[model samples]
Target chain A: MKFIHTGDWHLGKLVHGIYMTEDQRYLLNQFIEVVAEEQPDAVVIAGDLYDRSVPPTDAVELLDEILFKINVELNIPVVAIAGNHDSAERLSFGSSWYRHNHFYLTGKLIYDFRPVQIKGVNFHLVPYAEPGHVRHLLDDSSVHSHQDAMKAVIGKMEQNLNPNEPNILVGHAFVLGGETCESERTLSVGGSGCVSSDLFAPFSYTALGHLHSPDAIRHDKIKYSGSLMKYSFSEAKQRKTISIIEMNENGSFEIRERTLTPRQDMRELEGHLEELLDPKFYEKQKTDDYLKVTLLDDGSLIDPIGKLRKIYPHVLHLERKIESVDQKQLRNFSSIKEEKKSELDLFEQFYREMTTAEFTDEKRELMAGIVNKVLKEEAQK
Target chain B: MKFIHTGDWHLGKLVHGIYMTEDQRYLLNQFIEVVAEEQPDAVVIAGDLYDRSVPPTDAVELLDEILFKINVELNIPVVAIAGNHDSAERLSFGSSWYRHNHFYLTGKLIYDFRPVQIKGVNFHLVPYAEPGHVRHLLDDSSVHSHQDAMKAVIGKMEQNLNPNEPNILVGHAFVLGGETCESERTLSVGGSGCVSSDLFAPFSYTALGHLHSPDAIRHDKIKYSGSLMKYSFSEAKQRKTISIIEMNENGSFEIRERTLTPRQDMRELEGHLEELLDPKFYEKQKTDDYLKVTLLDDGSLIDPIGKLRKIYPHVLHLERKIESVDQKQLRNFSSIKEEKKSELDLFEQFYREMTTAEFTDEKRELMAGIVNKVLKEEAQK
Candidate 1:
């Protein structure tokens, strides 16, 4: 038995108000090419299939096309789960019909760790879930933490497992041995998300999502295929890959990572404006990559984007830096009398900097009261 | 070629704020049972599979159970389309994958009118579509009205069709020779939502939706099976049915309307509150049916709903009226008002009736201006 493992597509994502739909489409095409070339027996998309609960129309269309190609055209069985970013009900819509075509999609935890048997393999699918969601689903008042809920779920899963056959677990969650990303939803507050990697020792292999690094977790049998693309600046240095796993007759498996080259790579650069503007500066960098340029200018730069984009058409971001001010220089004076200014007057000045609208007399008075209360509390602390 | 034609399910419909989910579930279960009993080559659900685009969780589950039973459990080929009530983009999702299971669902209007070949019959599916959606999909700026857009679409569809085969056109829209309920959406203002029935004459048969009455449209070939259940009071008298269509070797077709009994019946009765509650009422009316009781009381009735439901547990509506309020007396009061009350004062009184909060001075002043403007305009007319 063989299968491809991938997850966290996060289609229709935007970073700092910039739409990444085109870039996402480019990377997803590469994913399709990999699927076509590798031609695995089955595919398992862990979770976080969508970036937001209410995806745009185009995003839905794109996902439809990809799923169609993988499940129908290629005739590969695809099993997917819903993550925190998805509306479980929406994801599970038409899933019953989908099951006939060998596409198993589960969004609810109500099934309580029931394993879906696909071609004699017991696949335990646990979609990304919070402690509260699990507790509500189980209707168990004692389940206060993710670990506790997972334990209960695992217990149920154990009942259905055939110990002789190979058992594979697919989940969309943060394991203990993975680096975190800003886009990945936090499952709990403290130790709730900290699931021990050894919990799945009974399984032949574990496929995971959430962490954006393909190699974030590295147990002999457990692994993370990361995301389909680099979704965050923090993942600029990370390599994106999809895993292809082949199981032998003995229930042992061989796994290999196939690197995906995104249509537009993400790259960050820092230097003076003159050096960056120089044609030689970008000679070493990929011109087609999504660029974030940081300028170490003394003051504000003029038309920085227009100039930089001339050389790099994909320059997505620009940041300017002046000489940093000392932390002590930013502190406020303790006594208003020492500065010969009333607290109300000081509040008026602060209000002007914070808001674009002009403050009225009533608004100024309100601001003064709030500021005084906050300052008094801070002083007491 | 033999197939079942069904439409206007409104799976999660609520009539007059009374939940009919149980009734819908029962009817759909019966529908699947019929499909299994008849064992048609294929099943065509014309449109309006759901009551709303964003259906409740329970509604989704109910729909899933039925679709799964028919398409998956029974191994029947299913083809569905989107209605006016559905979001096309959402419906279109996973359609590509669905094709693998021989379930072809199309939401967008196709310019090329090619029919799907099922058992040597060409199944032409025309989903319910707005003029704007047609225009956008065709990318033809010249397309304006619903009739024009439909004409263009049909013209495109005819090009790919083989008139020799047993061609069946499936559509979900208002057409000539049809009666509609309030539940069916109006296409436009004084617009031709009604297409000429002859447009689909080239096909052996046409299965239509949108109209609620099973006999809303009658033709040798073009027919509307109507909604599965009475979705509105206007459809209370309709005998909900599905068309079982059979195509002979010569490419001609025979159609029959198979009566469908919903899990719960829908009924309306009028009488005094005491009479409705009496054991005599149960002798004639089915207590298991959904009942709309109109209490014919001369004065205000006390707890009319509580009293009526004692016998008719499904009393969905209760209203009291004095038979003495003659239409002649109503006509004497010109403009429906005999009192010399200013429209402003009337509006203020109406506003107070609708809300628990007292109208503030600012709100009262605004309402006064609006009411005065409306009255002055009426006086001018």
Candidate 2:
């Protein structure tokens, strides 16, 4: 049996205040192309199909279109589960009817733990659930964390397991030792979300989501397909990929990675403003890529973001690299109480602090004229 | 071919600040029993399955559970459409896969009008669409109102109609001359939402939703199943029911109404407070019903709502019916302008207006003492 293992599509994700649905649609189109070419027996989406419980309409539509293409248009069985970012009830809608088409989507955890078997391969789908839910579900007080919740759920499946079949476990969890990025939401306040990798010892392959790195964990059977694209600046260095697994008649499987090329890469750049904006510096780079640029120049620059935007249109973050701030702060101290000063005086003080330049007589005169005109308007009101 | 026609469930409806999902669940369970007894060939849900575009999680779960019981468990086909309140794309999700299980849910209006056939009956589903959407979909500039939009959509379907088969039109529309209730949202600012009943001339039966009254329109073949329950006080007198249609081989049908008994009935009670509280008058009434009480006692009352709540726990609204208002008005007039008067003076004037009594010296002394205490506390602050 062969299948494409992927998760954390995070459809309708917002990165730096921009909706990523179009980017997701583009990448998913590519995914469809891959599915069409490979003709995999099944498509296993581990979890986190949406970025949040209530995703925007476009995200929902995009997911619908992609899932239809894979399950209906391409005629492949899809096995999926709801992650923490999803509303289990919302995702579970139409799931029973969908199963007839070989589209199995498990949202809430069930104690029976029936495996969906196809072509002699048993796929155990364990959707993400809170420890409290597991505790109540199993009538066991010992389930107090994500690890314990997963253990209790998976342990129930093991009891009903057929040892001869090539077993595969699909889950959404933060396996201990997996590398994480900023965009991945913390499942628990502390490290209680972490589950041991030893839990998947019985399965030939374990497809996981939650952490954003493709190489999040190192094991022959356990793997993270990673997110579809870089969701945060912290994941700028990560290479996003999908995992393809081919299982033999025995329980052993060979897993390979296929890298996905995002429309524009997420990257970080640090340099002097002038040097960074120069045509020679950015000509070879993907100028439209989402960027976090840090200015190395010590002095204040006028409208630095406005200037850099001409070269990098998608500049998401801009900040100055302040060096030796304590030395300059000590030299520029003044003892004028802000509450005792007029609006013009406060404006002058703010100008001096930002520019480290004197409030000249000409500028002060202009400021005073503006303040008077504003006060005159207020008096009339 | 036989089918149960129902719509305007408004599943997460809020009536008088109370979520009506529990009541809806209670009634829908009865609807399931009706379907089981009838063993209908299909269940046609016209539109407005939810109260809003985005419903609460419990509403979604309830809809899912009911749909599952009908389409999967009972193996009955379901034909549904998106209404004005529903987000089309969201409801349309999983529809493609659902089609295999004989569950057809149409959201947006498509130019291609295909009939979903079951048991020799061809059901033409027309989901609600805006004038702008219909105009764009048909590329017809003449489509400017709800009537015109419905005309254009149904006109397209006419070309593909199989006249030999028994055709049923399921829609969410405000047919012209339909009596609307307060809970039914106005489809348009004026009368543009009204579609002529003549549009359904080609179909054997036209099952509609939107209007809360089951007898909203007077036509032999065209009808509304009404909302699942009375959503507002204006609909308190309206009997909520589902329409069951049994169609014959000769393109004829018999429609019967099945009354749904809600767990709690909404009613209005008008009488003197003392009379209403008397067991002789109240013993025969359903005390648990949601009640709107209009007190006929024109005198000053202390916590009338609090008093009535002891007998009627679900009393949602309360008001006093003032008799001979001119008598009270003549006694309450004073020379002092309301804006210039102190809070205590304003309170005294309000009391006089309500009671038609003079502010006696003893009452005045008591009022002065309370005012002085309040002022002292304010001064300390």
Candidate 3:
């Protein structure tokens, strides 16, 4: 049995205040061509079909059109699941009837885990869920983290599995020890998001999402097809690809990589403004690609972005070379369990972000009173 | 072909700042029983399955459950369409596959309107669409108002119809001369939202929604199944019922109404606070029903709402008898093309509503600047 494994399309993504709909459309159009050429028995989109619960209208239309092309036009079966980014209830609409056409889309969790069997292969779809929600659903108090949640869910699923036949687990979670990029870097802010890969030992393979890098995890049996495109500059060097997996009756599989290039590649260019703008240098580069230009000059030039945009039409970002280190430091500070800051501390930070007004004792005291009242209500709840 | 024709469920409705999910659930549970006992050949939900686009999760679950019961469990064909309140794209998810089970859900309007043929009946499902959307779709510039849109849609549909066969047009629109309650009265505030009943003259029956009263139109062949419940205080005198239509092969039909009493009826009580609170007055009334008390006393009373709530746990509204005329005046004034007020006038009214501060000349000048800028943008668009 053979299938294409892909996920984390994030169809309605917006990066650095730029709508990525056109970028996503460019890549997915090519993806459909690949699917048509390969003509796999089935297509497995692990999770994260959308970037957010309430996607834009165009994103909804794009998803509908692409799914119709795959499942109806090409007559290939598609199995999709809702990731944490999706509204499970919205995705599961018309699901009861969808199975008749070999279009399996699972969103919400069910206690009785059943594999969608196609051609003797069992595909267990465990969509991304909060650990607390999973614990309540399963009536298990011991589930405290992503690892514990996945363990309990797979444990019950194991009872209904046939070890003799090949089984695949389609999931969306940060696996332990996986590499991360700046965009998805926030998922493991406190490093509690990842689940251990060892839990899927019973399955022939585990196809996953949420991690933007394809090589986030290195095990041959566990794969991250990676996001459809480079979501951030940190992923500029990463190769975006979908995986084509071939599994035999013996439960052994071989994997091949299929790379899809973005129409406008994301790149970072650092140089002195004068040298960077030289006709010789400008003529040699792919100026149309989305670029982040870093000026090496210590003194700021007038309208650097304006000047850069003339040469590189898609210059999306501009910065002094020295400020790059400050950004990195801020990023590190943000990920240092800083979201768990005290209420007053968080409020002070928010106040600074929202206004140029100074934080005085009078305002601080007023905020403190409100914060205490909220805490009181929280305690009562 | 006998079918249950019902619509305007408004499943996730909230009235008077009170959640109506429980009330809708109570009525719908009985609705399923009616379906089971009657065992209609088909179920045609005209439109408005939900109160609004982006309904709450519970509404989604309830609609899913009810549809599952009818289409999958009871094995009856269910045909539905999107109303004005629905997001067409969201409702049409997995629609291609839903057709295999005879669950026809039409959301978005298309150029070619095809009728779903079931048991010799050709059911034309014309979902509610904006006038501009229909004009753009049909490439006919004449489609301007709700009446024109419906006329153009039905005119195109008429070309594809076989007059000898029983044809039912399932639609969601305010037909001309349809009676409406306070909840849906806003739709025709200026009386432009309604279409003429003559548009459905070609069809054997036109099952409609939007109007909350079943007898909204007097035509024998054109009838409104009405909303699922009394969504407004103005509907207190109206009996809520679901229409079951028994259509024969010869295009003749018999209609029967199945009334479902609300668990807690909505009622209005008028009297002096003291008289209303007396044991004699309280004992005769259904204290548990949702109540709106009108205090007829000339002087104000202390804690009248608190006192009334002791006997009537569900006092949703309280008003002084003298102020009732003011409310009616406001309602009348609002429906008299008030929404088309000048930008500055509308802003002044909004400002008055939001703040106790008076609208001074200085603030008026500041607002005029912003309103003019917005009007400029609107003109450009």
Using TM-score, give the best candidate's number. Answer: 2
lDDT of candidates 1 onward, in order: 0.78, 0.88, 0.85
Going through the candidates in order, their DockQ values are 0.49, 0.69, 0.46
lDDT of 1 by residue, A228-297 (tens): 8887677888888889999875579998888877777887888888888887877876776788888776
**Tens digit of per-residue lDDT, candidate 3, span B1-381:** 899999999888888988788889888888988999999988898888888888888888888888988899989999999998877877877677778899998988887687999889999999989898999999999987889999999988988999999999999998988876678736545756889998899999999988888878889899898889888888877777899988988899999999987889988889888898899989998999988888877544688899999999999999875443346545644674755778797777655533434789999999999999998999999
Of the two candidates 2 and 3, the one with more favorable TM-score, higher being better, is 2
Write the number of the candidate with greater DockQ, choosing between 1 and 2.
2
Evaluate model 1: give its lDDT: 0.78
Score chain A of model 3 by TM-score against the reference chain A.
0.83
Q: Which residue runs of candidate 1 sit more than 4 Å off their true CA positions?
A: A94-104, A109-122, A129-144, A156-166, A234-237, A245-255, A265-323, A329-381, B133-142, B251-253, B272-322, B326-329, B332-341, B344-381
How should the candidates be ordered by lDDT, best one leading? 2, 3, 1
Q: How much is the lDDT of residue B280 in candidate 2?
A: 93
- Evaluate candidate 3 and give its CAPRI docking class based on DockQ: acceptable
Candidate 3: true interface contacts recovered: 0.62
- Judged by DockQ cut-offs, the docking class of candidate 1 is medium
> Per-residue CA lDDT of candidate 2, range B240-350, in tens?
899889999888988888988999999889998899899998898899899899987866888989989999999999977666457645444554564487767777776
